[model samples]
Target: MAFPPQVRGNKVDPDLLAQLVPGTSSRADVIALIGSPTAKATFDDNTWLYIGEVTRPVIAATNTVLDQQVVVLTFDGSGVLRTVERKNQDDSVPVAVVSRATPAPGNDASFLQQLIGNVGKFSPTQTDTSRSRQGGATNPGNF
Candidate 1:
C-alpha cells in the first residue's frame, strides 16, 4: 500500500515575489503580500524564510524528504527588502545517517546463560501468598 506525501509550510510563488520591488517594499508590505514567513533569522530579524517540504513514509517507518524549497528574503536595517534568495532540493546537502547499533556493556550473553538466567533465583518451597489471599488457584465450582 502507498501513502500520500505530506506537504508542510507555504509554497513560494516566484511571480508574486518578483513584483515586490527591492528597497521599496517594507517588512509590513512583505507580510501583507506573502503573509507571515515560516521562520526568521536566528541572530537577526532582517531575514525571513518561507520553507516548504514534501515528505513520504518509507518502509523503515520514517518519513523521507521528497522535495523541499526555501525562499529567503533579506531586508536592510531600514526594513526595506534588499535581496531575495530561493533554494530548492538540489541545493540541499545529503547527510549520512549512522545506523550502527550502540554497544552495551556485557550484552553478549550466551543462549544457555539467557535460558538459565532465572534458575534457582526464587524459592520453590515458598507459597504464593497472593494466590492464597486472592481465593487461591482452585477455581470456584461455577461462575
Candidate 2:
C-alpha cells in the first residue's frame, strides 16, 4: 500500500497574524503567537522564516508538489517585528533539474561476464578415505 506525503511546519493563522503589529510585537510575542520559526535568514540575523509544503507521489510518476507556503518575518535590531511577508507556490520559479546518473567506480560487467566470472575461481576435488584409521596416535590401529 502507498502512503500519502506528509506536511511539515506550523499552519499559519490569519487571525493570530493580524494581531502581530509591526514595531510593537517583539520576538517573544511572535514566538508565543506563531511558535518557533522553521528557519532563519542565512545572510541576515533579523529575518525569520516559516515554510510549509505538501508532497504527493503517484504511481509511475515523480513526486508532485501539491502545496507550498512561505512566511517571512523581518525584525529590527531591537527585536521588534518590522514586516511580514507571505508567499505561495505560484510565486515559485521553475528550475531545470538534471537527471544524469553517476557511474560507479568499478568494472562494468555484462550478464555473460558475470556468469563466467567465477568459472576458474573454484575447483572441485575428492578426499581420499581409504587411509588407515588412527587411535589418537601416529600409528593407526588398523592399517
Candidate 3:
C-alpha cells in the first residue's frame, strides 16, 4: 500500500476564534474551549497565543489551501501574563523571495580532462584475494 499527503476539505471555525478574550481565559480554558493552535511561542510561562491561515490558487494543479497559525505568550518578572499575540493568515502585502547561485572559483574541465583525471587516479598495482592460499596477499598485475 502507498500513501501520499492529502489536504482536508473543510474550513476552520472563525466563530470560536471570535470568542477569545485576553486576561479572562487561561491556557487550560483556551484548550477546553477551543482546539490547540498550530504553533506557539514561549516568551514567558504566564501567557499564550494561537493563530490560523489559509492559502488558495487558481489552477487545480497549483490550487492549494495552506493554513498556518502561531501562538505567542509573554510574562512579567513576577510570572504573570503580560501580553498574548496570536498571528494568523490575514490579507496583507506579499513578500518577495530572491535566490541567486554564484559559481565557485575553480578549474572546470572538459570530458577528456575528466576521463584522463580519473584514469590518472587509478592505482598501478592492485591485490587479488581470490589467488591467496594462506589468506595473505596476492599480486593482481599480470606483469
Candidate 4:
C-alpha cells in the first residue's frame, strides 16, 4: 500500500516514547527513545534539544517550510529527567541575541584596580623563573 508523502516520511514512534513516559531514562535510553539531538546548547549540557525541519518547494517560486519540531528535555543536577516538552510544528518563535555594551551603574573597582589587586597578591620576590629549569644529569661526574 502506498502512503502519502507526509505519511511516508520519517516519524517518531509514539508508542515507544509513550511507554517510557514518567520514567527516568538514561542517555542510552533517551537515544533509543529519540535519535541524536539536532543541537546541544552552550553552558548547559544537562538539557538536550532535538529538532526536525521539513521544507517543500512547490512547482512555482513560492517555497514553503512544511513543518518543524523542536523537542527539549531537561535533566536535573543529578542527571535525572526533570522535564520534557515537545514544541512541534509551527510552535517556535525566532529570537536574536543582542550584544550591547553598557558601562557599570556606579563607581566600583575599575579594571586596573582589579588587575592591581590580583598582581599585588603575588610574591614579587619569588623567583618563578628558577622553577623553569628541569633537565640535568643526576651525577654527570659519574660518567
Model 1 Cα lDDT, one tens digit per residue, 93-130? 88999999988888688999988997887874455654
Can you write out model 2's per-residue Cα lDDT over 1-143, one digit (the tens) per residue?
A: 67588776765777888889998999999999989998899999799988888888777876677888898999999999999998999999999998999889989999999989979775533112322232333336544
**Candidate 3 per-residue lDDT over residues 50-111, each given as its tens digit:** 54445555444564546655556554545434455555556345798768777899789998
Model 1 lDDT vs. the true structure? 0.86
Q: How well does model 4 score by local distance difference test?
A: 0.63
Q: Give the Å shift of residue 98 in candidate 1.
A: 6.9
Question: Considering TM-score, which of the candidate structures 3 and 4 is the better prediction for this target?
Answer: 4
Q: Residue 117's C-alpha lDDT in candidate 2?
A: 96
lDDT of each: 0.86, 0.83, 0.53, 0.63
Extract clashing residue pairs from model 3: 49-71, 51-69
How far off is model 3, as Cα RMSD? 7.5
Reference-based TM-score of each model: 0.62, 0.62, 0.48, 0.49
Residue 121, candidate 1: Cα error in Å is: 24
lDDT of 4 at 31: 76
| RMSD to truth, every model | 7.7, 8.0, 7.5, 12.5
Residue 65, model 1: Cα distance from true site in angstroms: 2.1
Number of clashing residue pairs, candidate 3: 2
Off by over 4 Å in 2: 1-5, 60-62, 100-143
* Model 3 poorest ten-residue lDDT run: 2-11
